[model samples]
Target: MFDLEQYLDMFLDESKEHLENLNRNLLKLEEDHSIETVNEIFRIAHTLKGMSSTMGFEKIATLTHKMENVLDDIRAGKLKITTAIIDLLFEGLDILDEFVKNIEAEGKESDRSIDNIINNLCNLNDVETTDSEKDSSSQLQDDFQYVTSIAQKAKDQGINCYEINVKLEESCILKAARAFLVFKAVEQNGEIIYSNPSTEDIEDENFSDNFNIIALTKLKKEDFKEKILAISEIKDVTIKDFDKDSINLDQVKNLTVNTGNKIQQNNEQNIESKNDQSESKQRKGKTSKTVRVDIDRLDNLMNLVSELIIVKTRLEDIDTDLKGQNMNEAIEYLERITTSLHDAVTKVRMVPIERVFNRFPRMVRDLSKELNKEINLIMEGEETEVDRTVIDEIGDPLIHLLRNSIDHGIETPEVRKSLGKSEVGTTKLIAYPDGNNVVIEVCDDGSGLNIEKIKKKALEKNIITKEQAEIMDDKEAAKLIFAPGFSTADKISDISGRGVGLDVVKTKIEALGGTVEIESEKNKGSKFIIRLPLTLAIIQALLVTVEDEKYAIPLNNIKEITSISTDNIRIVEGKEIVLYRGKTLPLINLGNVLDVERKSENNSKEIIVVIVKKGDKDLGLIVDNLIGQQEIVIKSLGKYLSGLSFIAGATILGNGSVALIIDTNSLFQREWYS
Candidate 1:
């Protein structure tokens, strides 16, 4: 029996890659109707068809086969590339994706969308202005596979064509290992001319227990089978002698080169094919390019480097004490090495913002159509780099902010015309480095924000008292729009305002030690500026002590820790309000929050208040004492301890004790009652 798992994974992977490339090429075909893009699109569809059929995903294979034919029409110049055709192609991709996801989730194909896309594809392909042209097209389709007329001269000269099928047991632990054993057995018999699953997948263990192979074996079929089954964990095997055209046809090359010889062989073969040569040239032509990496690896690497950075900072601190002494030379040398290491390691973790930006184009286009508005989205500062940990959490928040901008910020076409603004709305997404953080701004030129509507909504929710709403600062009220389940829409649209409010976006960003601030005008548009740290793996934190307990507050949130006179701490509204910078700041006694003892009888000049701000809201964190600031590696509280209310994450300091990093937003909420 065949091992189905490898084949299924191969099916899923090839389908996804094909879908991505199909989308990219479809986008390319729109701008430039070059023969290259059409051919590229055709190749992707062809691969998808083959993989789907082999995996027994008949619906996917059938639909993609029709899609491939239509693309062939484009490539052969029978059909011109148009937006309608592009839309059809995207529709096909979406259907295929939906089916692939169904297989992933439900372990079976989804037929709901397959028939609809296939019929549309058939109609699109079958269209003709006249009967003669349709006949001419049908004749060409019959002759489409002509490229198989390959290497007759080389083959008839005693080079026999062979097709080999190898199947492993379903209970096999390593299907790829079995595949490799089969590969070795085949090479011992003759050269493997072609493989159905592709060569890279064989090496990558990207195949099922049962894979088909076509080789030009010098030995007879029985000889090949005997050698393969002799291996341990061997199941069953079959070898067939194939026809002539299949012999010299270049099989799909999907092998990851392991040795220098394999790379050299591929390079030589690449030199022979103009298409291969051109793709290499095109890749080299790109000034800036993108690479896909698994986020988990980046996370782990960032963590290890962050700890090193923390230790380096500690070494620097140690050097500070020895600065003017006999150890100055060694200290200077240490400083140089540490500084260089910091720069290099930090660069390793700094990925460009383009990783997040590339996902927006399709989103904006679909959203504009959904709203029946003409909206253009423009992005800038794609080269801005942030720490990898920060990049992972930034995507959803940015998307939510963009969605909010479209739903609430931009006015309808008629409203914009009535407001004397351009009928088409334009939004700008800007990201750039600011101080030690990256600021992402989503600014729209829609009808700004309806402040009066927001005030009324706030009053209804009882989030604010009517008197507070009457005196609420416009800037403060602007931030309220991000509150939980809040929306100013009179009637909910299909896109947003289904009670999945911007509060989730705010909460997510804040959880990453970032801040989301709202800025808006009444009619011009609104700008949601999200400031995120360059890297969350490590941060400059204020190490403070309340009683005997130690904690870290992000240095970004602290303006300064002002030592207040006990006289300045006056009671207001039955709460201890400290006067700082000429304003009353609600005080948070860290000793109380941590439930620790406060040993202080003399309050004359002993206490410290760290002023922290989130958006426009500020709070004074009163700790029993301020332990000196230090750079610390932030670690999560694992899965079980994540919901620890006021704690953001825990970090291990140099002396091996752990300190809980203060949650900036949570502390802000804590101050609401303090």
Candidate 2:
């Protein structure tokens, strides 16, 4: 016996893919209601309905069935596309999304009723009543199986047998088309064992709107009725439990047929031959080229590669002692293999950022309608790929930033017109690779950040003093929006201004080992620039030592290394500063910050300083020794040592020793620097 649950995961995965396709195509249709878009939407919806019915998700199957009908009507030029209709479709999509979520969690359809949405969809096509009135008073014939052996096999396979009686609307003109649609709908849930008036007679409109179908399906009686009734112009659907045991094989075989049987049989054979040839051509035309791997499997592979690099480093250390040519060669070979393995793993984990960007256009559309603001979102470089881990964590922060732009950055059409700006505001999200970092910028052309308003809010919240506000430059004032619980909006609304400010976005982006910066000009617009590393698993780092402890600094942050005399250091406003390139730079003592004791009590004549850049600010880190540069694999310090502010992560060195990776961004937050 075949169990439907065995294929549940595959069904869910394919269903999700179809849902995503539906969302994308619907958005396209909303933009331009072309016939091509409508046809595509209808196809996706049809596929989803079939899959849902097969999986026993009656609500989803019914909802999609109704949607398919509406789309079919639109394609046939029976209905005009309108904003209200599009919104209703979007609402239907939202419910389907929820259904998928429920299926993911509980391994079955959600218990929530979608009757209201179904009614709306049906009403769009003037379908007054969607629910079928069960007329159990009239039952189906028990000995009516066309093929007794197939019916027995279907029963053995756990497929429930059903006989459906469908009635079409009185005003339905294309009777043949509606009957064909009915057959397709029934076939999606199960195989049709027999149809009254014969399949050919029904297709030829040999009967009225009423048709009877004996189907071998896994769907329950009520579920099957719902699936059929969901179709537009489907006046009423009646279903009865078909009993295979009660079917008499001898009686079914003895049933007589006339000359019509010869013609029907000949037609079916020709149709089957054509279908086989089409299927053969399709199979030969396409190639299976890709496979979906679990992300966890890739993460495990990355971990194994990291361990191998560590072992390879240890081997090199041992080879150095032997100094044998063969040993050196073997170690070098191992090094090459490990390097190649690392690169392969990194590429495997790389995913395009478009996965995160694809969900925004629809969001922006909804926001525009809600805010009464005409805004156009232009996205560029969506194909830029980054680490999957980075992609996963970056979505929410980007969503928050985009929402902030929609709510605060972009002005209303009326306001834009008043300012002599174009009535439609433009928001742009651009991404590109800059060295080892992927930079994403979200910009808007509207009334830019109001520095004075932000200052006033900060001052009222006591986030900054009045004196600070008076002396703050435009850039500095713009940063105040990131303060916790700060908002310039006069009244709180659902869109924003409920006390949670841009601080959340800042916190999340930084948590992903990235940084966010603000750039704004009054009445010109604002840009939020986010810089993130390509991958966090492996990186080239500059190793330095402070006393006996070794530390690694990201080479990307290091601008230059120089030896400066202690006497060159100067004190300005009670802060240690250095004059480099005719500019004063703050100097940080790495040893003191790490609380490491000095190796030599005797004062060294020259101090080695590393100039590092964080955004527009530069700081020179004072360390005891420079250990050159090396590629290292980052490892977490576990929960016990998790909160160390200055340490980003730990990495295994070439000699099997551990080195702490420095968090350069945190350096600026230290009290010594502030």
Candidate 3:
């Protein structure tokens, strides 16, 4: 039985991505109207329709199907490209986006008022038809049919189908790449009706190198064909006719793996050798094997494994200290192997940055038009990877950032041309791996962040004191632009300025362990760069002890740990503050924050003052003592701590105790209460 609710959520996520892509690409297609771009738009629509149909979202599927028809018509050149068609497409996208929002709130497909949108799309059918409307079946296949057509003509010149037997050596890396090359070479001479693992998995790069099947047409083999011997990874390729009886049933029967351990000694080697032996038992008809699980399910699995890994590490450490040297060595080896295994498993939970970046161009296109501005969006290094958690939250913040760019960052085309700049303003979305973090940039070649306007607005809104405004630098003043209800627009525009707190974006990003930074020069444009961690499940954490309780502090926030004397812990406005390197550091006692009782009152007890940085501000975390660091897997705090913003999460220690990991920002955000 299929779970409708879970399937609906999956459909909703997939639909949002598809819709974003459609909206973005539609705008790009309007400007260029090239055949290739139109075909891409058609394909995206086709995919959305198919996905919606499978999920039983009838309204969305029906609407998208009509949209696909129009796109197909355009692709076939039956309908001439026009600004009207693009406008209708944008209208469709807006309706779809609204429907998606309803689903997100209601947890199912929405009962959207899509009647007008559907009628408008239906109106496109009245256009005069062109002769380019050939049968839809006469389209391109993934394989180049033209090349195959040329090769098929040689069949009369002593060419025939040959079944090639491929045997792969063990311990081969780059299996998918090697297999792809072999397939291309074999496919040149013949057609591949079947592969052992199936073609989809091969395309997704999801196979190991051990077996291959090729049905070749150019088989005049007195000797074994081709340069299969030249490929470094492939062991051998033997070619023969596609005979059912010719398969090595023994080799097919035995598929085994060995981690190569000596402790198993005779028994392990016996099992290995026995698996290698093939008997005359009837086969199971060579059924393909693979499990199709959703990416979210994989994330849940990783979370479980990460917790178990922490416990495993803690156990090994204890076993080493208490159980002598030899037992420690064996446990240490197991720890090494499993830790690497866990790292590889965690990599599976990451999504490519391209998933988030590919949906922007069309958005920039329409907004520019509606606002009567010209903007070109350039994307770079989109192959960057981030945890699925980060990817899920990243889309909207970038959307608001781009909209702010279009409506406010870029000026009107006439204004731009007058300023000696290109009439077309350019917006860029770039993502690249920076150390252990992913940096996403949304930049535009329009008006930069207006500092004076922002400062004036801040003072007028009472966001900052007059003295503070006067003393603050242009860079510092720009930060106020993200404040709640901070907009430089003279009047609220439909595209960008809403009364809602733009600071919510900053808050949300900070909640994800990400920091958003902005840079601008007068009349040049503004760039918003968001730095986010690659993964949230695992991080190098600084372990500290406060009143006999262990706490995990993310290493990213920790500037350094130092011993602060009682003299250094000075009083500023009756609040305990530490003077470090000629600056007053606001200090929060850990025990007080968690409501735990302190053990000692002596000022000489030697405090581990951890200097933590949240943006430009700094705070000192005063702990009873510092514990050594270890790799611990983070676990969620569950529903009990639903509103506990200060506690990011908890992690399991080796001895099976849970340590609460502090959310540095939330902790810093609270000082007076602490």
lDDT of each structure? 0.72, 0.78, 0.70
Please tell me which model should have the higher lDDT, number 1 or number 2: 2
Task: Give one digit per residue, the lDDT tens place, for model 3 in 22-46.
Answer: 7667766866887666767766876
Runs in model 2 deviating more than 4 A are 1-12, 105-111, 127-287, 318-321, 497-500, 571-574, 597-602
C-alpha lDDT of candidate 2 relative to the true structure: 0.78
TM-score of each: 0.73, 0.76, 0.70
Show how many residue pairs clash in every candidate, following the order shown: 2, 0, 2
Worst 10 contiguous positions by lDDT, candidate 2:
130-139
- Model 1 root-mean-square deviation: 9.1
Give the per-residue lDDT digits (tens) of candidate 2, residues 8-74.
Answer: 8788888877877888888898888877788788779878876787678889988988887777557
lDDT of 2 at 10: 81
TM-score of 1: 0.73
Top-scoring candidate (TM-score): 2
